[model samples]
Target: MKITFLGTGTGIPQDGRVQSGVLLDTGKNLLLFDCGCGVLGRIHESGYEHKDIDAIIITHLHLDHVGDILALIKANWLLGKTDMRIYGPQGTKEWFEKTLDVYDYLRDRFTVEITELSPEEEFIPQGTEGNCNCNIRSAKTAHTDNSLAYRIESSHKTVVYTGDTEPCQEVMELAEDADVLIHECSFPLGFPMTNHTTPDLLTLMMDEYPLTAKKLYLTHLYPQMQGRYREATDHIRKYYKGEVIIAKDLMVVEIQDD
Candidate 1:
């Protein structure tokens, strides 16, 4: 499996970052997570066609996460690919329906199937011929009332992608023993915040509930994290003895034997 960090920033824009989005490739299918504001453009910039995405799993309904979903679907239609399966928390179906209702031209331009998922639900997306068997599971995240974190396991390695969450036990438990945990560290140390994480808050929680993943990559950064990436990783390093990296756009990780 290959996980690509398409956009690592949050709602607030930064110079090098766009918004919250990631892509996972199992050499069989492409699974996109959280198509935020600039994600469609980033997909094009990353040299991948928009129609290549097999499915999209959204973590929440936050604008930074779901902003460009329409654009993605539209682009796929332009490329003669009209099928899309979207998995998201409750209200997802309604959200898409309502969004489409507003755009008269888009309502009939393409067809998209939206599935509402609950925490702990797991399913395998339909794949084309000669693709590896892959499965995805979701766990409730504490960022919002309906936020979810996802774990995708294909071939052998597992990769956990936390949408936008505070340091919560449910997400940590869901991520246990995974090869890579891609979590959101939105703020720097000593920043008082809620519904999001800081380096101090994460380590403080890690003191009680340790993360067992082989590596941790932090994404969904805010402008506040600017110039503090190394410090954030160093702080978490003291508590979690694993690879900790601050994810950048276009960074790719291959989940194969190292």
Candidate 2:
């Protein structure tokens, strides 16, 4: 599986970064996670055809995460590819409906299948041709009321993507023993925050609960993390022995052997 960080920034704007979005190329199909603002352009910039996305899995409904979802769906429709299956936490169906309700021209232009998922539930997306190439699971996260952390496993490797979360045991357990944990380190060290992560808060989770992944890639950065990349990694390394990387836009990771 190839994971691409299409947009690594948060709601705040910054140079060389957009909002939250990532792509997992399963080789069979492309699984898109969190299509936030600027993700559509980033998808094009990343050399990925927007129409090739088979499914979109959302972690939450925050604007920073779901901002570009409508634009993407409309883009696919323009490309004559309208069939899409989207899976997400509880308010997903309602959110999509409400979002589309405001756009009179876009509604009924495509066939969208939205599935509402719950913690601990696992399933393959409906449109996979044969046996699903990967197993996808979700766990409750400490962000919004319906936020989720996802665990995706191909035959060879497992990866966890934490959308936007604070240091929480449920997300930690969801990431246990995965090859890479793509977590949100939204702030820099010593930045007092809530419902988001900082290097200090993440390491606190590391020291207490322990992230067992071989590598940890931090994304969903706020402007606060602008020049603190090295310092953040240094702080995390004090508790986590694995490689700690600050993810950038368009950075790619192959899960099978990374």
Candidate 3:
């Protein structure tokens, strides 16, 4: 499986970072997670056709996470591709309807299948041929009432993505034994924040849950994280024995079967 960090920034703008987005190529299918602002252009820059995305899985309805969802659908329609499958936490269908209501011209131009998922629900995203060769499980997150974290298993590899949350047990349990945990580290080591993560807060949770993921990639960075990457990674390394990385926009990581 291949994972691409399309946009690593948060609602707050920063240089070189856009917003929350990740593209996962499971060899049999291409799945997009969190199509935030600027992700559409990032997809074009990543050398992948946006129309080829098999499904879009969202973690929440926050503007920073769902900003470019409509833009992507519109872009695909312009390119003569219309069918889209979108899966997300509760209210996904309603949110899409409300958003589309604003664009009178774009309404009825294409077809979108929206599925609202619940915590602990497992489902398969269908590819062009049929169901993709992977399974996805969702867990409720601490960021919002319906925010979720996803565990994707394919080709004997497991990857977990935490959309936006503070240190929480539900996500930690869902990420157990994952090959890579793409978590949100929104603030610096000691920054005081709520509803978002700091290095200190994450390590505190790790001390209790004992993260078993083989590798950890931090994303959803805020501007405060600038120049503190090494510090944050070092802090987490002291508590966990896995490889720690600060994800950057357009960076790619691949996991292969043993």
TM-scores, all candidates, are 0.97, 0.97, 0.99
lDDT of 3 by residue, 5-113 (tens): 9999999989999999999999879999999999999999999999999999999999999999999999999999988999999999999999988998998899998
| C-alpha root-mean-square deviation, candidate 3 | 0.7
What is the per-residue lDDT of model 2 for residues 93-182, given as tens digits with 9 covering 90 to 100? Answer: 999888888998887799898999999999987553544588999999989998999999986788899999998999889888999899
For model 1, the stretches where C-alpha displacement exceeds 4 angstroms are 128-132
Which sections of candidate 3 miss by over 4 Å?
A: none
What is the clash tally of candidate 2? Answer: 0
- Per-residue error for 118 in candidate 2, Å, reads 1.0
> Candidate 1: minimum summed lDDT over ten consecutive residues — where?
124-133
Pull out the clashing pairs in model 1.
Answer: none
Cα-lDDT of candidate 2:
0.90
lDDT tens readout by residue for model 1, 8-116? 9988878989899999988878888999999999888887777888888999999999999998988888878877888899989988988888887887777787889
Ranking by lDDT: 3, 2, 1
Cα misplacement distance, residue 241 of candidate 3 (Å): 0.4
Candidate whose TM-score is highest: 3
> Could you tell me which 10 consecutive residues in candidate 3 have the lowest summed lDDT?
124-133
